[model samples]
Target: MACQREDELQELVDEARKIAYEGKVANYIPALQKQNPEVLSCAITYPNGKCVSAGDINQSFSLQSISKIITLAIVLMDYGVDHVFHKVGMEPTGDPFNSIVKLETSSQAKPLNPMINAGALAVTSMIKGKNAEEKVEYILKFVRKLCNDPDITYCNDVAISEFTTSFLNRSLCYYMKGGGVIHGNVEEIMEVYTKHCAISMNSLHLANVGAVFAMNGVNPVTGERVMPKEVARICKTFMVTCGMYNASGEFAIKIGIPAKSGVSGGIMCSVPGRFGIGIFGPPLNDIGNSHTGMKLLELLQEKYDLSMF
Candidate 1:
């Protein structure tokens, strides 16, 4: 049965790769604009230690907004759930991923959730670092340890490009500061958040990262406990509730797993006690999720019965 499932997963990977040809690479960021839209990769690691991958699994892409989940996890681990919640709420905001109106509306607008830009910046600020560089280094070390890939580094071109075009995010940071939700300098927080987004990794590494969460913070392959069980649970919950921006609701109904998407066309999913999936295709749908990537997850979920709920 395991071998048969592997065959089926391979078939799905092949079919999903073909859809990449129908989409275009994301062009907003100059760095992301150069991605090969036709490139597709899928990697899945089951809880019992089975694994399968196909297509351009070696292709690298920036983490983009996907870094939000990692930063939020680290913050929760370092500060506990209660302390983190005091700065950012867990409710899903029905607005766009980069919406600043929500931040300016009320004194209580504490960034809806950590998956969005506003909330991610807030989470980044809560890392307890003495300075911006310290915070970025801390995040990098945590991410490398989570994936067990020490070679992972920030893409300077991607980071600079995002920083140059992040007027909205900068505005959100200032608004958060005004609300007293973020304590540090606005520039420092934005720099940390943007740099994290700029960190690059391939689908295989991302799959391992997701698998760690799926195994409740333990890297099944290495037997390393990267985070506490409760922190992993909270990260998964946020992924299910707000990972795909406004499209999260539809993704939950269809895929039925805790997942997160980045504007760079990456999707990271976790099926508790089952498997972790990482997929990449650069074209984005209206809601900033990878179009082909979403369809691929739906197909995999239906075929493998991988839905958590």
Candidate 2:
């Protein structure tokens, strides 16, 4: 099946590339401003250790907000779901990912979910670490294991740049802190949050991580259990609801599976019981998702009837 798909991968890439220009690169982040907005890349890995990839598959980009999925699982793995949920709600807010409305107005002053900025900050605070560097180290180590790529690394430049311009994120963190949603110094917690966002991956590396989620926390290639199946269930459930920012519903309707997109033009997706896909196209739509990446997934999902719905 993978061999068959490889034959037509270029056709899909060409089709998606046409619309890449409709969206522009995310320039606010200093390090991301230099990305080639026209580049479109994808890699899909099947359970049988087969892979089909095309375009700029070797190019690396920061994980951006997509790191939230793994971090959510990490905190859940360490603290258990009940404790993690106590700090953050289980539902999406339908507002922008960085919006501060619910954190202040909600009765409990909790974040609506872990995938958004406010909730991600709260969840990051829950990671059991004596300091920010230690917490981020744990995440780096675990994500490398998840991807099954020991060399997977963080982009310090991206992290420091985000930290420099993180006024809104800091506001969200401190606001949640005041409400008792997160317990830590605002700067320390925000570092943990944005630091994870800087984890870097090429399309293939990102797809490997997606494969774990698709395979219920097992790496089909190495036969390693990365997390409990129950934990993977929690991750996928959130990916469906909040993974694509407010466009999650649209993505689920169109592409119709679990997926998460990052600001660095990376999208990670899982086709339950089948395969995982990674995409990178720097230009972004109004909703802050990879423009060509989303289009390509829509086309492939439709052609292959991959929608879980």
Candidate 3:
């Protein structure tokens, strides 16, 4: 059965690549504009320690907004949900991923959810680091644990370019600081967040992340607990609720799985007891998700009935 699934998955990967032309690479970020919009790939790892991949699985890309998932989950584990929620609320804004108007309108000045820029800033502030460098190290350590790849490091070019061009992000950070939702040297925190956002990994490495969620934070291959079950649960909840930016609702209904999409055209999905999936399709759609990635997920779930909902 696994072999049969792989055969079909490979075909789907090929089909997904063809649809890349239907989308466009993220143009707002000057650094990301160089990505080959034709790239598309999928890597899947099942709980039983099997792996399957199709397309350009070796292509590297930054984690982008997807890193928010790691940061939020890590903070929740360290600070507990009560403390974390005090700083960032758990509701979606249904606005652009970087919208600042919502921050001003929010009653308590809390970022609507950890998945958005304001919320991610609040969450990053709660990461238990005494300074910017320590905070980045903590996040990098967690990312390495998830991928089990010590050689991993963020893309410096991407981080630097994002920092230079990110006028709106700086504005959002300062706004959050004023609202009292985020406290710290706003510059340091924003730098830390951008660096984490630049952590580079390929599709297969991302699949391992999904596989951990598949086992409820346990390394299925090693039996080591990678994350607490409760923390895993919260991460999955947010992935379903707000992982795909403004289009999250449609993705949830169509794909019926918990997943997160980054502006870099990467997605990580956890299939509970089945398998973990990571997809890279650099062309983005109207709502900032990888366009071909979204289509591929819909088809895979249809083929295998992988939806949890």
Global fold similarity of model 2 (TM-score): 0.97
What's the lDDT of the predicted structure labeled candidate 1?
A: 0.83
lDDT of each: 0.83, 0.88, 0.86
Mark the 10 consecutive residues where model 3 has the least summed lDDT: 1-10
RMSD of each: 1.7, 1.2, 1.4
Error of 3 at 250 (Å): 0.9
Candidate 2, 22-131: lDDT as tens digits: 99899989999999987888889888767789898889999999999989999889989889999999997679998988887886679999999888888888887899
Clashes of each: 0, 0, 0
**Model 1, residue pairs in steric clash:** none
The local distance difference test score of model 3 is 0.86
User: In candidate 3, what are the lDDT values of residues 105-178, reduced to their tens digit?
Assistant: 87767888999988887887787778888888888888888887898889999998888888888888888787
Pitting candidate 1 against candidate 2, the one with the higher TM-score is: 2
Greater-lDDT candidate between 1 and 3: 3
> TM-score of the candidate numbered 3?
0.96
